[model samples]
Target: MLEQVANGKLTKWLAPSMRVGWSMVETVLLTAAAVGIGLWLRPEDPMTLDADFRWILLVPLVIAMRYGGLVGVWAMLCLIGCWYVLKTSGLYAQQSFPEGAMLGGLVFTLVAGEFSDLWRVRLMRADSAASYSLERLKNLTQRFVLLRLSHDRLEENLLTKPYTVRDALFRLRSLALEESSDTALPAGDDLLGILAEYCQLQRAALYPCRDGVIDDRPVAVLGENRPLEKDNSLLAYAMENQLLAHVQQEKEESYHGAYLVAAPISNSAGKIIGVLVVERMPFLSVNFENLQLLSVLLNFYADVVYAGKDTHLLLERWSALPFQMARELVALGRLREEGKVETSLTLFVADDSEQAGLILDALARGLRSLDLAWWVSDRTLLIMMPMTGVSGLEGYVLRTEQWLQDEFAFMSLRQAGVRFFYRHMDTRSTEVQLAELLEAGGV
Candidate 1:
């Protein structure tokens, strides 16, 4: 079996390389042999056989056609020299060297061979362009097919019940956020039940976490008569790698023969908090998409734990949310109008990357405690200052630009060159104007 596998790989490797080399070799050798035979067939005496053997030139013509003009020129020189030697020795025919025929053959070889080479080059370029276009078309088609399948799945799931991927995620987020008011996660058993139903698993178990290590005892068990062992390698492997594991059942005697999947639940800090073991029900094949969705939901549960059950502080630091920014903007506008405080909002739209993040970090450190910033898009950030005006905004922007230039020499944050866009909101503006500015992203 090993030898067969090795031979198969060797054949695959040789197939493409051998094709061009073998064809060139075969054409060169075949044409040379034909030329030799033609010379031998010529009569010894000039009386019986014709001295003009124009048919012999066919060998060089073919070489010029298959190879190129340069190769044809070289072959012509060799053939002409051989013909001269044969004729002078009276081996070919009783005649002197045919200089006119030789010259004609040389011209023919050069012209025909170069023309063929030029045509072949053009053909190859055209083929390469076509292959590139075909590959792009295939990629587009595959994306379209995947999108169609996703849409169909969404519709089918929604028609069957109100619970869909969106609802499952929203419920998970709500549960995570609820940690602020409570110490122990409320309804841990119910949450496990929700997960089991969402993933359509027949039997499952959930473990509680203490000080980063998952408790061996099951905190919640669903649709199972007896609890499974927590020390299994399948669960241990998933927790160690921080990934979902699907144990393939090889036979009834195998270790994971009864279970289908083992997954870990981790917090934002990547500390394993729980393990979810599930059994595959008949006729229901688990898929990658479902596994990913389950993993995200579990991670959110972990995030809740990491937040120390405090929803407010978690929400404040994670200001990349539009609604959060909008709420703060409304409060700032009201405070400005009431003559209680002076505040400004700056909209920064820069390319999304690690470098842009550095700019954000610098701003975060330099700004006051009341200042706020959030990513409105993958490439845009909105910053709100509780007590800053237009002049203060100008200084902040310039300082940040200087910092960016100093840190990354290749990148200059000049007004014209940089993709970053920023504008300070007018605190004197009316509520309607504030709303308009927020809606239009300061235009």
Candidate 2:
């Protein structure tokens, strides 16, 4: 209650008032000084000498400057009137009132007038600086937000979807549609495929050979709807040196066509995952903003390859997750398949009806209810453990055995189907390797 009362008082004390609390304070102090000085300076003509009240004149000026501009003017006029009354009443022996009044007015005009001018300038400067800073902050925020959205879309295309020629072509075609003014020039085979389709490079097969020449071996070439030129040495050179090059630069002179460009793909860890390229003619017309967007999109492409952000969705559809989940059940019924991390997936087919309820009761010991990323395929549950390593797969499998023990005590958990397969992460080995390990242990 006391605090509330104090706040109310503070609200009433808003400054810049002519007859406010501070002005009253100045008035009292000045009046007292004038009275005291009059007696001290000339006691014989005390009223007459102080009648002008030269010192007291400053009180109203100070109040006006600090509070209201119009109040200061009114105060000067009042002081002059007071001096005349003192003189006319014969309280002052002064011959005329104008002399004292003039002195008081001069003092106010010089002191208070100068201060208000200086204060206005200072306030204006401060306001300008604040406005500039706010504008800059807003612009920066806008750029960051745009970049984030671009990254999201990039991950959706690169990491989540299966790499197919037709899929990639669709993306490139979409970009052309968006930038309607750009020429629909023929897209170079490799770069065009990824650009119009996947927002990546078409050069998946080009790699460095033993003799330092670029070789097209080990590339994932789409048959018939080829995305790369067969004998182009320049394309090979660019991919071999990890060089940034245009897909069109390698095109035959007779055709005189170039619409794609590609760079070697790198993962989040900066290791080359594969070559990433884009195909689009009239690309030179793209502005700085658009180019920045492309760079961001490509970086996310690398993330998909290395991070396995959406790999779970595909595996679930296959009814066989990429191995970190349900390791025990998947490990059964396979003799040749190694219970590995990256090379294979371990599936634990969970039953939805009777089997699910039974499994939940049996494995109710320590297994957490909040499983992060999981997939059900062929009635099997596949878990992607990004932290699991090959060595840890066995332990994860053991955990599975315990879960299975609740229902089929004699189901010899080791008799489940466990198969390991290697995913081609192109050149992004470390990230791919790490992903593989994570999927193995469901970490």
Candidate 3:
């Protein structure tokens, strides 16, 4: 499956070169065919200028429509070359060139090319936005599943387990921050221990993956487990789909696998950095709820593993802020630096603390799944929006204003004693910008 993915990527990488080559070939052949037809009709004027309509201009127009302006210009040059060929070969021809006709054709081709280019860019941007949205949706779906499962389990095991899932995650974050080892999976044994307690895995192993390839050796193992197999079906399925796969998922296919469950551990950017394979677990524990918890826990651990050193420093500086928010802020900043996407941070502040608190509660209730909100103080609130640009921020602000008017009967934000400030993530250091924003909001 990995090999197939790699091949598909390679094909996509070479598609542009193949497209250009094919376009060149088509331009040459079509130009030749058009010249042949023109010569058959009027050998004296192969360009067919003697006719009321210039039929030869269609070649460049077609090429322009198909391959854009550059290739269309190439087709026009080929026509010029054909004309010169006729003139030099002593075929009957006019003394002067048809400059007006050629100029008109060039202008028409360029106009068509410009339209194509414009639509191409629009389509590319739309596709990129869709892909980012899809990834966000997938992440949110996993979180929702985990939430539902956690709630159900809490009802059953509230007395048995002293700490909630959130507490376990906080401990995981602490482990990530404090680990000094250079291995890819920091506090591997502790992570597995948490999973064992939560997922009821009697025997499992966590194997580190580098560059999409899983290592044969296990970084962390619980109880007695077989060594990692090179051709494990569950591992292949999990890596292929970037999700959790278990024996019950496809009984006919996965029943033959040596492990009961396999899951990929992916970072916030959705890159798999590790794999967890369970060799032994109770039959009742192989259900969807338990598997979902396992996947979520692995993903949570992966996020902590991927958080850079900058995130740790930010956490140390602002102990009140959540680790997840700090990690996302740094990730968005890196994305902005790479010119892949933009993020926005909005601060809502009010002179009246009571009004601000009310507004903050309302905003909290209306927050999107992808947004992270922090109640910075009694008089201030901060929201971080991922993959949002200036235009998106404007729309968000407008919507919030309308909601305020409808919910609180306030004429405007100013009337409600509220003011908003926004900043788009830029090339500056994320930690520095965050500190500045927080200080400006008087946090």
Provide backbone clash counts, one per model.
4, 43, 0
- Give the per-residue lDDT of model 3 (tens digit) for 412-438: 777788877778889998888887887
Worst 10 residues of 2 by lDDT: 331-340
Please give the lDDT score at residue 278 for candidate 1.
76
For candidate 2, lDDT tens digit of each residue in 331-410?
11011121211222334443345545445333333333222234443333433332244655667666667645654653
Give stretches of model 1 more than 4 Å off.
Answer: 1-41, 45-53, 91-95, 133-443
Please, what's the RMSD in Å of model 1?
15.7
Tens-place lDDT digits, model 1, residues 14-66: 22222455545655575567655654664453221244556667767777776
TM-scores, one per candidate: 0.39, 0.28, 0.41
C-alpha root-mean-square deviation, each candidate: 15.7, 16.8, 19.2
Better of 2 and 3 by lDDT: 3
Question: Better model by TM-score, 1 or 2?
Answer: 1
